[model samples]
Target: MKKSTKMMFFTMMIIGTMITMSSNSWMSMWMGLEVNMMSFIPLIYKMKNNKSAESSMIYFLTQSMSSMLMLFSISMNSMMENKMMILLTISLMIKMGAAPFQMWFTEMMNKMSWMNCLILMTWQKMAPMFICQMSQEKFLMSSALSTMVGAIGGLNQTSTRKIMAFSSINHMGWMMMCTTFNNNLWIMYLLIYSTLMMPLAWMFNEKMIMHSSQMMTNMKSMTEKMNITCMMMSMGGMPPMLGFLPKWMAINSMMESNMYMIMIMMIMMSIITLFYYMRITMSTMMIYEVQKKWMMINQNKNMYTSIMLTMNLLLMTMMMFF
Candidate 1:
C-alpha cells in the first residue's frame, strides 16, 4: 500500500509537469504548478527520515507563495504587462530554486532521500524553468548570480546531497543562460544533466552515502568508485566527457552573441565548480586503503550500470552532432 501510494503521487507529479510544459496560457500553467506541488508534498515523506516532513512543509510554503504570485501576475496581465512579466519571472525563479531565493532548496535536499533529491533537482524545475526562459532579459542577472553562489556555496560542503543540490543550482545558471541563445539549448542541457545525475544518485542511494568522506569509505567497489568519479568530472564539464558538450555550446553561443562580461564571469565560476568535483575525487584517487573482501569477491557487472555508463560515452558522441 505504501509503495503503491508513492507511485501514484510520482505519476501525478510527472503529469503535472507535462501539463505545465504543454500549456498555452499563463493561468493553465499556474494550475499545473499547483497540481505539481500538491502531488510532490506527499512523496517527500520517508519512514526513516522525519526531516522530510519539515522539508515538505518548507517546500509547500515556498511553492505556494510562488504560485500565488504567478496567478496574480497572470490575472493582472492586461493592466500591467511589464510589471506582470517581472512578477511572473520572479515567481518562476522562486519555484526553480535559483539563488537569492534558494534557501529552502538546499535544506530540503539535505533532508530528503537521494531519489527525492534527484526529482527535486531535475524534473521539478522543468516547468518553472521553461516558463522563465520566455523572459530572457530578466533571466540574465539571476543566471549570473546563481553561477556565482552555486560555485562558492558548494566549496565547504561535506554532504553529498547538498553538493549535488548546489551543483543543480549551478547548472540551472547555465541552463538559464542557454535560454538567451534559444530554447533548444536549455532543453538539451536538461536532458544531458539528467543523464549524468542518474548513476550518481543511484550510487549514493545504494551505498547510503551521504557525505564526501563516504564516497571513499562506503563505496568499496573500484568500478563503482571509478564510474562515479568520472561522472562527477563529466558533470563539472571536463572536456571529452558528455557534460562538457552543453557548456561548450553555451559558451560558443555566448561568444557569438558578444556577451563578453557575463561569459567571463560564468567561465570563472565554472572552473570553481569543477574544483569541488575534483576535491571529491581526491579521497578515492589519492588513497591506497585496505581492500575489503567484497571488493575482490564481487566482479559481476550490473546490466543497468553498464548500460548507463555506456550511454555516457555514446551521448558525448551523439550530442556533438546534435
Candidate 2:
C-alpha cells in the first residue's frame, strides 16, 4: 500500500470512531461503525494473501452481525419502550464479544497482526462500552455473567494475542461490574485499565511476531528480556502495578456490595488467568525456548528500542502506583 493511501485510511478510521462515539442516536452509531469497517478493509488487505483475506472476511461478517443486532435492538426499543432495555443490553454484549459471543475475538486475534489486534482490542471497544454505559440498569445482570465468562475464557489461551483478547474481555466484565457503583469510580477504572492495557499491547506488538509461539527469541538484550517479563506480570494484575489497582478496587467494591459469590468466582478466575500469563513470562524470562539449529531469529535495533521504551513506561507506571 502507498504511504498516501495508508495515511488516508487511518485518518478515516479515527474520524469514524470519533463520530460514532459522539453519536446521540443509534443510527449515527451504525454509520460510524460502517465507516470504521470500510476504512479498515484496505488495511487488512495490505498483507495481500489468502489468510489475510480469510481473516478479513471473518472480521467483516462478525462486525456486520453485531451492527445488525444493534440496529435491531434499537428498532425493538423504539416500538416496545421498556423492551428497549433488554435489546440494548443484548446488542452491546454482542458488540463487545462478551461471553457466548466471544469466539470471534479469539479467532480474530489469532489471525491478525499484533498492531491490528491492539486496535481491535482497545479502540474498537469504545462504542459498545459507551452504549453499555447508557443501558446500565437493564444490563447489570447480563454484564456480570459475561464478565465471569471472560475471566475464565482468558485463563487457558496459549496464543499471546488470544490471551490479550481474553484479558480485554475480563476487564470489560470488571468494568461492567463497576456500573453498579458510582460514575466517578467507573471512569477511573476505565482510564486506569486503558492506561495499562494499551501500553502492554503496544509492547507485545513491538516485540512479538504474530503466530510465533514465544517472544523471547526476538529479545536481543537482557534489558529487553527483563522489560518484557515485567510487562507480562503487569498485565497479570500483579500488585504495585496499575493493572492491579482496578482489580483490587473491583474486589473491594464487590465485597462492599455484599456480592460474595461473584467475588469468589472472580478470585478463582484470576488465579486461573494468572497461570497462563506466568507461563508466558517464564518462556520470555526464566525458561528460554531453545530454537532448532536451522531456525534464525531476527533482531532489529529499532524494534528492540521501541519495545524496550514501552515496557519501561509500563514498569515505571506501576512503580508510580506504589
Model number with the top TM-score: 1
Task: List model 2 lDDT by residue over 1-322, tens digit each.
Answer: 8989999998998888888878888888778878988888778778888867887888788878877867787778757866766666666677677776788777777888876776777777776676666565634565566666666776666677777788777777777777677554566677776666665666667666443355766654555666666666766777665567778887888889888987787677666666777777676675444456356454554565675576557657755764
Clashing pairs in 1: none
lDDT tens digits, residue span 1-322, model 1: 2889988998999999899889888878888888899999888874446697899889999998988898888888899789888888888889999988989899999999899899999999888877876555457898999999999999999998899999999999999888877558889889989988887788789789899887787666666667777888988988878888889889988999899999999989989999999999977776644475655545434744685569666766677676
- Model 2 TM-score? 0.82
Q: Tell me the spans in candidate 2 whose CA falls farther than 4 Å from its real position.
A: 182-187, 211-213, 288-322
Top of the candidates by lDDT = 1
Model 2: how far is 38 from its true place, Å? Answer: 2.7
Find the number of clashing residue pairs for candidate 2. 0
Provide TM-scores for the models. Answer: 0.94, 0.82
lDDT by candidate, in order shown: 0.85, 0.70
Error of 2 at 230 (Å): 1.0
- Local distance difference test, candidate 2: 0.70
